[model samples]
Target: MEHAELDALLTPEAMTLLDGLDPVQTTNDVARVVTRLRAAGHGPELVSAVVGQSRLRHRAAAKFGEFAGRMLFTRAGLEQATRMSVSAHHAGRFARAGLRRVADLGCGIGGDSLALAALGLDVLAVDADEVTAALAAYNLRPFGDAVEVRHGIAETTALDGVDAVWLDPARRTTGHSETRRVRADDYSPSLDWAFELASRIPAGIKLGPAHDRDALPEGSEAQWISVDGSTVELVVWTGTLARDGVGRAALVIRGGSAHELTAPADTPDEPVRELGAFLHEPEGSIIRARLIGDVARSLGAGPVAEQIAYLTGDADARSPFATTFRVRETLPADPKPLARALRERGIGTLEIKKRGVDIDPAEFRKKLKLSGTEKATLFVTRIGARRTAILADRLE
Candidate 1:
């Protein structure tokens, strides 16, 4: 957003209009509101800002829940903001370690700062972008003196008197709306500096879940978190916040419940064995944390193939760490024969899952030419030295 639009949107008139309007969800709603606001003599800047924010509020609901209604956001900031549920867990680490003051450097839209302050910890939220910093201040206004928002570079932010720090360095180019990812070497508050700071203070540094594990600092706990079914972020904990003897952790959150699997280090891969009665697909976070062996042991299972993530077992075990599927039979690996086999069984509504194979599920699905009322899952993966297709049903 431009400074003029932001300045105009902060006024009493514009804010009241934004709050009073019905939920803006569709393009039709946006057009209707824009026309009405313009007809009512509202300036182009105010109308554009209010309507744009209305659209953003609708999108922000998935992250902030009901709190999105009263908050402000920039397009790029909203995209990078941490989900409330995950940020609360980050805050819990600090609170559990008896730390009360936190410096949330690069606090995009105050997502983490909001969680920190809600737990009664004093927070100094800093953002390098002036507009984003302003938006953070407005979003965190409800916390009163518990939170302080500042516009500054994270690398130079003063951390004096703070018990811990939360670093979310900028991983993308500078912009309020459109931006693109940059190389890790180009990250603001370079990893070298961030790691140095964490060594000196109790800190939590959030990074992409797929970040190079070999580049991670020693003596820090690396935790990979997945919400619903998507692996979201990897957090590195240092100093007192880092749990003793725990170097790897996987946290899986689905709906209202959460489960965690932790180990001193990445567990060795379970031995590969012949196919069994059931196949298990580990959650993305577990795969990212390299703790698949632990989950496999818990279920009395082993890998379906060497270096393959799929696990198979004879026991009917259920776990939050992985999804279980009952193997029905093996089908032809070739698409032509597979389609004929699927047609013979009258299978439709197929969920195609593939790994360790070079094929697009969507394009492969089209070749099936399916027409049926039944449903099943097809696993196109490698078994030993050959590609294989397994037909199965998901066990809820």
Candidate 2:
């Protein structure tokens, strides 16, 4: 970020410059007017206004960044933290589940740490950056009395015996931001590092939902956790871990509904796609736990193809594994003819779901000129040796 860029984003000092407010000045006007006030000497009134808006804007941006982080990191793009509020039962569940005496390895702004503390858990949250650590401490101050914020790299921190350790590794490389990656071995607190600690005590490691299954360590309970139907983070549990028939669980928050599903673990070298009356793509947890079979069995569904995560059956199934989309029509895959047919059907809104094949969804939608028509599910995959797209609608 350059100095000019920094000016665009409010610095702590820039925020202090806007003081006081008219009861009537809207937030937008305050920000815009504050920009002008910066040129004139800042008075006590202007400074107060800036501080008030500063607090609001800081919190909003932090919330947004955290939301984006959770989405991109999860399999189903789950929203971990939100203004929507936490579930009371879910809050107590983590506490009842022996997550107390917690060690939040990378407590980014204390989102999880705060949630844990709210449930009466004693959290020893740690972070590497002095700035972030300070900010985390400030954010967590409201939890009061129970939470202790520390500053250090968790990989090097001495955690002799904690009830449960949370390993949220830092993926940012030395300089360039694009250097972000998900190398288990290279994280500041690598997966191996977390797993090694977990081997000693109960530990939960948060990983990218798009992780490779072949790389998972033995003797760990792998869970694909989702919130509100969207698969969020992959949780690896070691010690006291159970091999749930299905690895994927739709973790319903608070007093809301919760669904736990599983999938069969697949042999990577022998990949296959399952098709049926309804094809349910189990969440990552189901895939990693290799419990897809368990989910299909529970739903009375069968595999469309042998190894593919997709399941099929003559009956409509209610499973958290996948959204139920009915087969409105089925035909062979031909881009030009399919587009023409769709255009005639007045179907312009498309959701291209791809599995075995590699075709860009955006490019396909653009080429098809999808707009102002209708919504439909497009499945692009390979059957035998050819790839095709099947347009369908929600089953129920």
Candidate 3:
């Protein structure tokens, strides 16, 4: 958002108009709403700001829930903001460790700060971007003195009076739209500076799930978190914020329930064995944390191939760490023959899952002429040295 648009958005008139309008859920409604507001004599800035905010509020509902209706956001800020569920978990870590005051550096749209303040922790939320900082202040206004939003560079932000710190560095390009991921060294606070600060203070640094594990600092606990099967972020904790003796962890959250598996460090890969009756695919967070071996040991399973993440075991122990599939048949490796076998089995609706292969599921699905009432998941992966396809039923 431009500085002028933001100024107009903060006015009492804009806030009232935004509050008065219903949530904008469709792109088709935007033009009508924009025209109506303009016809009502609202200036372009007010109309654009109100309409834009209405759209963002609806989009943010997935992350902030009902609280999104009362919050303000910048496109980039909302996109980079941590999910409320995850942020609540992050806040709980600090609270559990006896932390009372926290400096949330690079606090985009005050998402983490909101969770921290709600947990009764005094929060100082800092963002370098002017518009983002303003939006954060407006969003966090309900917390009163419990939260403070500041406009400053995270690398130089003051840590006075704060017992702990949370850093979510800006890892993308600058613009609100058309932003792309930059290297870890290009992070706003720079990983080097962030690591230096972490070593000196109790701190938690949030990074992408795919962040270079080799870049991790020694003695830090790296936790990978996934929400609803999607691996979201990796958090590195240092000093008192770090859980004792825990070097690696995977936290899987699905349908509001959270399950965690922790290890002292990266464990060796489970021994490769023949594919068992049941094939288990580890959750993305577990794969990212490199703790699949721990999960395999727990389930009495082993990898299907050397270094392959797919686990195989006949055990019926349902685990939250992985999705289990009951193997029905192993189809031919070639796509044409596999498609034929699937058609013969009366499989119409199919979920194509692949690893260790270079085929697009959407494109491959189009090639199959399926017509039947049965539905099954197709796994295109490698077993030993040969590529294979497994038709399996998803197990709960």
Clashing residue pair totals per candidate (backbone < 3 A): 0, 34, 0
For all predicted structures, in order, the TM-scores are 0.98, 0.74, 0.98
Query: How do the residues 63-89 of candidate 3 rate in per-residue lDDT, one tens digit apiece?
Result: 999999999988888898899989999
The lDDT values for all models are 0.94, 0.58, 0.91
- Cα-lDDT of candidate 3: 0.91
* Tens-digit lDDT string for candidate 1 (1-396): 889989988999999999988888998999999999999999999999999999999999999998899899999999999999899899998999999999999998999999999999999999988999999999999999989999999888888899999999899999998999998898888999999999999999999999999999999999999999899999999999999999999999999899999999999988997999999999999999999999999999999998899999999998999999999999988999999999999998899999899999999999999978999999999997799999999999
Predicted candidate 2 versus true structure: per-residue lDDT over 183-230, tens digit per residue? 666777777777788888776676766667677677565666655445
Candidate with the larger lDDT of 1 and 3: 1
User: Against the true structure, whose lDDT is highest?
Assistant: 1
Q: Which model, 2 or 3, shows the larger TM-score?
A: 3
What's the CA RMSD for each of the models? 1.1, 6.5, 1.1
